[model samples]
Target: MDWMRDWVQAVRECEGGALGTVLCLALLFVWYCYRVGCEHASYTPESRSSPPELSSAKLRPTLGGVRTGGGASEEELNGFAYCQSPECFRCSRPGNGFNQRLYHNLQDYAKRYTWAGMGRVHKGVREQDRYRLCNRPSIQKAEVFFLPDLPSAPFFSRDAQKHDVELLERSFPALLAEFESVYRTPPPLAPGWKANSTPRGHWWTFYLVNQGTTLALNARRCPRTWRVLGQLRTFISNNVFGNACFSVISPGATITEHYGPTNVRLRCHLARLFTLDAASRGERRLRPTAGPERLH
Candidate 1:
């Protein structure tokens, strides 16, 4: 009976100590939460007399209102966008104004800026930019004695990329399927022009032609793309002076602002596939099962 009483007393003491500790912890947590809530409720915007600088120690801004690198996620940006302020990013205006960036990479900022620039121009500022392609100096014809110029043929006409587009349209499904099959397959990642990581949603490239040269190995790997490009050899034999590859920029991935070395080439994007919330944004989602009026 004495041993039983002693054991009971020890258990009671331990339980009482544990209960007191738990209550103390609970009170501390409640106080912390209360302090946090009070701080949030009392928060006010800091004076914005000066332009916000995002760390002079890092993230140097580049030409064309681009920054090389930063630290932010799309989710954070989206949450900010939902705030009552009418700012493009974190302010109270439609325009971000003065080299504002949202994404970690400058490319995303450029794309978003371009998207904003697509809107109707207000006052003197246009969201869109117009820049001329700089002709390649080395490829300049001595007899011509001037900058290189493309043929004056209508671009979409039968003589131009019409056949190429048609063939690609026909083979788009096969390309999509093949891409889905081989894009993430073991050892399927082709080298990027800028070797970004896999987590950055690889800028995967399966070259049909590169710098006026056909890649026999890559073509063998991607037969459908090869067949589609093959159909345009007659039209593109001479004009295929530069790379012709499908550049698949991964979702939420951003490539920095860059201009090709030569203006003699134009990279073409045949088709795009993305998933987005169509209902909220008042845009229709084009699904494979949806009415394909133009598929015929």
Candidate 2:
């Protein structure tokens, strides 16, 4: 207290000694006050965040086909038309509380369970000879399908374990039953999709979900399959891209070698009714083809 009083007395004496000194002190005081006010305003809930109801209003779409609030429409903020509903898995609105948490959690999960989409080079190989080890046979007639700048692997045994494909494998009987009950007749075939290596046969596809979207009618028809699909966290469930389907390649049909559109996702194939002869391994052929493949 004595020190405080002495300091105050000294400051008082200094205030009377020079006008320039007083002006400097006054300017410092004003700056300090301004900073304090800003800090206080930043900490207040009213300044930091709006009421939930009011903030939610901004997320809602208006009559003009643009999002409201947040100082600008979504189109203006992103500089293009971007309309992902809050419910979508890929709706990455980090400003919103739920989406922010979800986005971070997904990122963490992906980091732990997935490859970061990098095409790995063989260790200890010289940079100049990198292509020598990875290249295909020169005699192959068809052009090799290549998706640029993505992790390439012949198999994904690790991804199968990460996605818990064994869980789906255990429930295969239920999935098969659902498939049987729903699709009594052969599902339609893809024409422009991929022709049979020979012109005589057809390849049919029965899809419960396609392009990260659950077909409502198909989902309703096969509840068990739908329920099982939802349990896998790493399954490509985004509305923008991904697929879950049953492909039936008929006897005497040969599907020509093809590549998937992207290399980021592991294309998993579950043999619902394949024999385990000496040539075949166990039922789980957790093959990683060149695309977004998931457990179905």
Runs with alpha carbons beyond 4 Å of true place in candidate 1: 1-160, 186-202, 233-240, 276-296
Q: For model 1, how many clashes? A: 2
Q: What tens digits encode model 2's per-residue C-alpha lDDT throughout 1-296?
A: 99999999999887788877888999999999997776444344453344222223334445564543433444333322222444332223233453345346656766787735432311211121122123333221111112233444466664555645776777777976775564454344322122212222556666677657767876777788888888977678873347787665654443322234234466567664332254446432222223332431
**Candidate 2 segments whose C-alpha is farther than 4 A from its true place:** 1-151, 158-160, 188-200, 274-296
The residue pairs found clashing in candidate 2 are 267-293
User: lDDT of all the models against the reference?
Assistant: 0.44, 0.49
Candidate 2 C-alpha error for residue 284, in Å: 26
Q: Which 10 consecutive positions of candidate 1 have the poorest summed lDDT?
A: 127-136
lDDT of 1 by residue, 174-256 (tens): 87776655455423433322232332344556666764677776667678767766676443434224456655555565443
Winning model by lDDT = 2
